[model samples]
Target: MAPAIRVEIEKKHIDEAIERARTGVSKEESYYYGDRLTSGLQLRVQGRQAFWALKYYNFTKTIGYAYPAEDKHLPSVSAARKLAAACKDILDDDPKMLEPMLVKYYGGADRDVKKAKKEMVAVSTGWTVEETAEAMIAARTKPDTDDPIKKSTVAQFRLTLRRPQVKALSKKPIADVTKADLDAVKREMEKSPEGASMIKKFVSDIRSILTWGATHATDMTSLDPSNIWWELVKSGKKKRAITRSPIVDDIVKTLILAESYLERPLPGRFSEGKFGVGHNVLNALWWLALSAQRTTAGTRLRLVDFFPDPKRLGSGWYLAFWAEGETKNGKAFVLPVPPRAAGFLQERMAKAKRNGDSQWCFPSSQARGKIEIDIPVDRNSPGGVTERMAVRDYPTKDKIAKELAKNAKWESPYVDLLAENDIMYWSPHDVRRTIVEVLEEHGIPGGASAVLAHEVRLTDDLLFVDNARNREQYLELRVSRVTKLAYGAGGFIPLKSKAMEVWTNTLIDRYEELHSTYRQARKKAQAERVLKAIYSDANSAAEAKEAAYLELPKIRRKLEDNLTGHKQMLSGLLKKTPPPDAGVRTARIEIELAQADLDAFNTDPASYAIEPSRRAASRTHSAVLQSALKTDEKPVDLVVEAPAYTQLRDQFIADKIDVHTFRLLITERYPITLDMMDDRIITGMVTGDEAL
Candidate 1:
């Protein structure tokens, strides 16, 4: 068939083989050349062609034709030898390089040439951080991919680098990006705990961009942020570079005011009408505080996720909530909400029943009134109005963020109400933090974390029982304690459950005192301003009468003191005859003068009525002034009066009146005059001591 000649291919042999191969071949024959230790190149001959080939270790390739054909496209003997030498050089440089080097030398026939050329171009060109980031974003967000990136992830990446300080570095060449640039980003956000958390994310996003670019676009210089793990010195102490929860009491106070604002919304500036959104926000705040759920988990709650306790007879004493695909850890969790939160949930259910039963508990107004797409329709109708297609929409982190921002907007209708009540602003996460702290302070360390975990276990298997009912009961007991302590609502269990009772009472007391003090301060400020206005306006005669109306109490006290002193002197008048008569006459004359002055003051304003009445036009001012003052007092009473007992009875029946609500009512009734609402009074009104 063919010659089985094995020899080291030399220059002369290649020349002779090429000349013979141009004629034709009977079968395939090969002559190998180069070092045996490193493997060899082959000059193979078959039917009408001879080509150069290689087999070195794992690498095998057919480089090119060895001899010229009709088209004379094949390499000459010397050229083939040069190619073999080039392949040998590439392999000598790197054993892995045979495919790519062969592709480079041979051109169009090889698929790897395109890859090689692209790699060369990438290595040669310098890519800026901005350019590489855009490329990375595009690649991640490509359409019709098996695993598309999350929209939130894309937005986060865009936002992280868009900050003014970090944005400047985007124009820097990737190769020139040093750890210093990363450190600069950290420095900008390191001082603020919230900002520190963002910095960590920003660094993570940047590193991801650099890593992606290293493989896809350019060889990025190593920028591992881990290498720059320097401690953030704050107040000379090494600060823990992470976001921390806010103080528990601050959150509690703010939530109390938030609750009040929800009830009586302030006048609107930006939005008009009722404050349904405020109700949603208030519920979200309580839910997060009681459940210690992440914002996403809580906001994404659906009506279907709730499982009411059979034992509670659907009073929502123990409710289990589980939202799929909406957890920080990415696992579905069955969270047991405490009694207070359950009460809130029960109210929400009633509200939803009245409001068309929206699918989500905190549903977006945008998606609340949608129609299902699967509804049967007349296909042949010439013209018909069809309902908008319904889609399952869950509240996302972005949506919740926008809602919170809207609530806190300066132009928000309710902002003035919060401000007037001395309520401060706080993020939703702060509630979770506050819950954690309250739990820890009252002997449930890591209790809040268990609230967020899929399994409800913390330092014991109380919640890990094999029986579902026992597990639920344990979860309820655990969650109930924390909620009762933080919210000061739900039927109080017992003080014997650790220090929950004392801790809860202390927190509630602190919140009440703070709220009362702020109210008193506001009242004092208002009083001072009113008095100042009265004194300033006393320049006119008619205004002086109004001023006298305000000064009525001081004037009456002075007149009573003078009459009492005059009567005391009558005891000594009986001792002497002339003295008694003289004393009696003197007393009569003094009384007459006082009566005369009082009569003049009560009549029309005279020019010489009294020293203080110099500005009074006439005595008739007193009559009008007294009526105006009484009218003002009536409005004050109307403003400060508690809701009627009928309303209180309705609220109590609805399970809407909490300890805070009761305290607020009492405060409204007496304001700064009362020390505190008596617990006995509250007990009589609310029934069991557990409620207090």
Candidate 2:
């Protein structure tokens, strides 16, 4: 036997012990230093190495190493003191709890201790790990807070605990579960073909249960929730891959539109057993896609929770509520959806009220005909709505997974579902992600966070805070919490509404209105230019113009044929087209666009057309008059530049024109009639930009 002594368990004492351990010691010998600071912890300083162990119930077990800070494998002096304290408490109150723990760490004891263990096991048996987990699950069913554990979570938790490797460990006494056993469970999870994300969730769920059981379960009283040795078991460092594929927005719109057109035949090839899923199922899925809400709270939405005229806000828009604890963020959210989504929801709610359906807007209806009233959707809960929707519209491999209770529950492939829409293997969760990404891409940033009802930890907020001091806008984005402190929840409505509008607009396969608007703008500008060309054209002075000159004004006398005639035609069309239509709007835009062209035409003296027969004679007479009137002036170049440019500098000095008009005359190289000058200045002023 080696010598044993008591000493303060500090770094200095440990360093001294390490020195003694390395020097003046035989390789075969070992020394034991009992911790003076803690009751059960001791330092085993051997010739080759040192260890931290706990002595309790006639057996001592090596828990960790003692030197070189144990290469992060073992706790340091401060952490070891805390662990030693916990061990002291466990040993003083329930030493047997540490018995299996020691056996697991140090392996089987000598024959005498093993025989004693048999007797000890017979008397002090506790609940198995499986029992502790079940108890934890049962406690979860009765929620302690408003934020209750989801049924799907509990179900998934059950599935993870029941795995073969986990099962074998779970069957053992809770106290016997060693670091190695937990590590083995992690390896088994890693072997699963379900991929890293699923494996990650499995480890996380099991870890939560283990932690909850340590504090909550009766048989797991002695275990520390925070200090469980399973903390060493990691889910690996691999980042989870994005499993669901991105869908084209136009394809998504087509899918939504197809729902109204495609008749999902009942008792079809995809519909396996019972009649088939009804419209309610599809509606729930659509709501998820439109709202970007989780399946649980979204599918369970009651009609009353939807406020069509919140605070008497408006008719076309709406405000929706999900109570606190219902959402993943655990905050009550008042959401606003697009007009189309709101319209559909209102129509459904109105129909439900007429049908005397209790609360759920979408009731159970598996029949091919009209749905039955007074119950929720075909499923009582939101648990398998995604899977059922996938099966009916899109097929999934989930039915083959052993975790699900049913073996392919009521299989059906309603032909007009997601597959017919070309996104066959769809995830409703990814649908939420898809829309959020679209909104972020299209400049409505808040819609991304607001869709999932997420907290505002976005990079937008960071930029806002960072740029606030610089007094510069870092982003031209959506109205988020940073911009809406005074408006509160109501402010998000319009922002989210705009986001949905942008999303829906993007979803349109052919944006005819947008194209029409662009084309109209181009034609308006082009029409004005064409009119100017016609006004100045030599061929426009008709033989008929000289006859009409008897009763005409001088400007009208010069406007012999083309633009003057086209203006008459434009006026005629404006009279024939009905008011408030695209035709009237188009006529008005063209007329407005031609204002400057007409004014500039009338202002320039040379733009006037002359009678065709005498045009050469009239120009020769004008040239003779100008030559006779010249006095000591040099001959000028044939300048086509507008006369306004030569006089605007003097006009500006005299305060006869403001900055914009000055720029317009100098830069645009043109002038307008007095009547249109104000409008021209206002429109032209927008161009006065300078580099800082």
Candidate 3:
């Protein structure tokens, strides 16, 4: 060990020198030096500096230092004495002896240096590096404040004052903190349990402040206060987790029940004054909630975005709105009204029109002019006023969200209603989630990401190809598939079957009418043939009979002419006188010849003079009869006019035939098969001569 040394001071002199030191003299001339001399001991300075000098004797040794500058400069004598006593107590140790003198000298210009040195002594007695580390971690994990920094800053100011907390905390000394000191602070916080959280947060804030100072402060030698705190304290307890709101089925039921309340009548003044505005105000709120839109760049919607009616696009009305502000994305956005939303708008428009509010669909009652009220009424305002209105102002987006929070117990009322009913929700952006879900359920290709408008994850080939063209092709394929399912082959089954039934009945009726007409024509032709045959037979018989009659007349005339010529001969013979028997014999011979000629004409028309003409008429009648008989030949009738064989043959030639009955059979029982037919063929079936 080192040699022992001793020194002492006289009470009066020590006090006088202390007074001088308090008056701001240099430490060499202060009470501490006088104490060494007064002790009547040999003084050997271990260090040359006056403040750091050590006095020693054969018996003892001691270091001496002056009071701190701040304490020395104080006017109070008592305060100076107390500071001197503190300095004297510190002189026993190596660090203690130099620290106070250093603090006295540097404290005015460098208070942190003095404080750090003091804390170093405190940490040596009480804290460890491990404890400091723990405190730092706890600080980092602590909850942040509502306003961590100013809302906004100018560029120049941002550069100068950025991370101010970090700069401030980094300069703090950590060695001074003790574990007991940290525990005491925690105990105090627990004493007021309500403020415990706040205390913990303060500790955390301090730690973060120190960390920032370490990283950003101009001085690098200072201990990080945050690190010191961590070593002094364990991590604070974590906060309990909060539960999210449940999207229960009861919420859906509640909304449905509330829908009727939307249509309830307002308190009416009846014959005295106008109705209470509550009903209208509430109803409009409901409508606005139902019509939630993105109101951002992706889907910017305005008053003009709506079509009045879905069913009648051309006949229905439409609304257009001009937006004033930019969208959330910093880009302009415009949203089109889908069919269903348009229909809803149209119905509302008609109601408003009936109320004589034709000029404005949703007018602002407090607007300065017609142009000001051009947009849809803000839902939160009474009497359709805006937020800036002098009377009833509209609620802001935050206010609206707060109000909705009270009612938003379900996923979304609009989404539930629209999706469940098959009328897709197209307005609110979250409804897109519902849409994508539905598309996925249907197994439509590319539906999942497409509905969400996500970037496509494409193969190399697809990426090289034009995405737009591929998208079009994909859409067309989807359309074709849907069409196939809807139409079920020849045509849409439901409509096509009904149409075919009507067409078959009509064609059958027409066939019956035509058959009746054809039968009549056949009968007429048969009658004409019968008449010609009868006429031929009658003419042949008549011609033979007329020839016999004509033959008799011609024969009689010839006999009479012969008799007249023989009369002259007979007169000459009579004058010459002749026998009576001889005259009678000649007359009998002439009568027999005349009778023979008549018999020959009757036996055969060809034997007489008129026979040739009769034979020619008979031949002509026979030819006419044969020609009419041939013309009247009839085809064999069958039960079925168009046979299966003929139909099959026709089907091959035409690819398919509208076998009236066959089409009906296929439509009802084999609809799927019909769906497989080529689209071109199906189209041809519709335009062809076959029954529909």
Candidate 4:
């Protein structure tokens, strides 16, 4: 081989160099002449062939051919020097980018240059963006780094790639991803859901995968470095606000509505050990509202992650929790659980324990199938969740209010209730933001960063300015050692506790007000108005009183018809098994209310009546409707917990309106007997216009 030599890389010098390479070079690879204009630039010649080369960071790369006789597409002397100078600057920052640059601009037209890399996967036959992204995901599965990408981050990465514009472009290999294609993808993502605020983060994630691929040539050898990714990697960071700050009162009301939904009996179908994850969903929603943590923090939280802090502050023993090794900043989160929240924590602990789910604080409530064989037999056996909440049995807020309504087909109260609270829409993440904002307002400026599990000193350099790094002088501008020590576990507790207490108390006050409103509304309900006239009014028309009393049984019969089909279906289920625990509790209430409705029908309108509790009377409407839909298989000897309205029945029964045996006869779950009805009342019912 000819020896390397220095020369001005002009067209004249390049021509003279190739002629000498033909005579002096032996049967070897090549000979080179160095450039004075560019640091790593060289003109390499091998007999009849000559090309521009660069040796950046010790690795020699063929820039392109310089021999006109060999190839007409040769770059000019000045153009080759310009390309070399630009590439050398990029290499100074990241030397790993050299292989990708060659794959992109080899021969001045992105084709293989076997002189630099051992092999290359060209854009035409190589892995698409999707395929390379998958490779990146796999490599990160057990990544060997202090800070690794999270599974959720990978999930978002895949979702961004699936967007229409991005997905279409991803079908092409990374090397073929042009600037036009990337710009179009950027616009599409910016207009997407959560776009304006999250677009930068999404684009950065894509660039990360490309960087991973470019560095690891054995896995992915080819990609167009000229694509817009390099420009975007260090681009401007101006995050736009997408979600508005949550209205603090609306947050409180949302919690109130969620509690109200949970308090009601589960709708009939969901009540039984119906195969579902409903209870977990409802409980999870409440927990999320109270805690104000990320959805995953609450959803994936295990009972084990929360150990009570031994340092009990006042009467409350606060819990210190971390995000199960998945905090966004990779820092441990230590927030104080206020007194109200601690009470809620205890309540949830008791509930989870009752269901035999000690592991997950929010466990799946899925029940084994109570549904039986199609052959003629009772399909349902005694029903309840057979599996306890355990490891990885996380919670979600889907279908939260579906099982709360008496009528399952009706639109879930969850949606309408949120609307009533004047929250057209809000998410768990919105709640998280509101909590953070509250902390910021109450605490010192930038003091709330610790609540979000961020390192205050690292993320927010309070004492330092941006230009301070460019003009360094002093040892440091930071705070004292005592201040740093104070910023640890003990310092944050007071700030966290105050924020939590204010929010929790606000929510509790709102909830109590809502209950007061409910009481006022129930007093004026239509059923309440009719009952007062039928039993209490002293000087009403006899015909109006008889007519009002007559309407009760008619409403019962209509609702009872609605229950028939469900009862028949339920009987078939019970022949083999029993109802689910929730279904059983609710069904028992329905049966008692239906029996009470029968007793009210059989009683004669008294000359002097005792006033009944309006609350119990109003509850009767839902109970009657619920009972009609219950199954017929009865447990004769078993005494289940009774409904609230049963007290109203007891009030009338104690009045001795009829004989004790007479009361027992009418209340039994048998076909309604007309034997006790007065002839005049019966005739009045036969024809409403006729006299009582």
Query: Best by lDDT, which number?
Result: 2
Candidate 1: which stretches are off by over 4 Å?
A: 1-244, 260-268, 271-277, 311-316, 348-354, 368-425, 456-692
Say which candidate scores most in TM-score: 2
lDDT of 2 by residue, 1-692 (tens): 37678777777767776777556457557677787767767877776567788776686766567653433234356656665555555567666555543333334343233333344432236667777777777776773432247666878877877777577876777755667776677777677686466667766876776676676764554566667776666778487666674565433543353344324433243445432334566566556666767776677666655554343356566555555565676655556656666775565444432234345666554323332335556433332443343443223444334333354344323333443445445555666667777887888777777556644322222211223454333322222322432136434656767776676555432322234454465445433332222222212223223322332355544444434555675677667636346655666666555665566655743323222223432343344334333434432221122233324433443345654665445434422222222433212212212110
lDDT for 152 in candidate 2 is 66
Model 4 residue 602 CA deviation (Å) reads 70
- Judge candidate 2 against the unseen true structure and give its global Cα lDDT, from 0 to 1: 0.52
Error of 3 at 439 (Å): 16
Instruction: Give the per-residue lDDT of model 3 (tens digit) for 1-692.
Output: 12324334334433443455445544343223333333322222222221223332322332233333233233233333334444444544553344545444344554333353454433133223233333434443455422123222222222222233223222224444335545555555555545455445545544543454354441432555455445345536566443222121222222232333343422221332243233333334323322332323222232323334222247432222222233332321122233333454455544532222313344433444444344334433422311111111223344445655775432211212323333322222333343333344445424323222322121111111224557567544433332333233322233322322332233223333345453465555444443334334333543444444556566557656665555554555456545466775565565566556555545642334333334544565666456546745542111132233223322322324333544444344211123323332112112111221
Order of models, best TM-score first: 2, 4, 1, 3
| C-alpha lDDT score of every prediction, in listed order | 0.49, 0.52, 0.36, 0.50
Clash-forming residue pairs, model 1? 541-615, 603-619, 604-619, 605-618, 605-619
Of 2 and 4, the candidate ranking higher by TM-score: 2
Candidate 2 residue pairs that clash = 270-412, 270-413, 271-412, 271-413, 272-411, 390-394
- Which of candidates 2 and 4 reaches a greater lDDT? 2
What number of clashing residue pairs does each candidate have, in the order they appear?
5, 6, 30, 12
Cα-based TM-score, every candidate: 0.29, 0.32, 0.21, 0.29
What's model 3's overall lDDT? 0.36
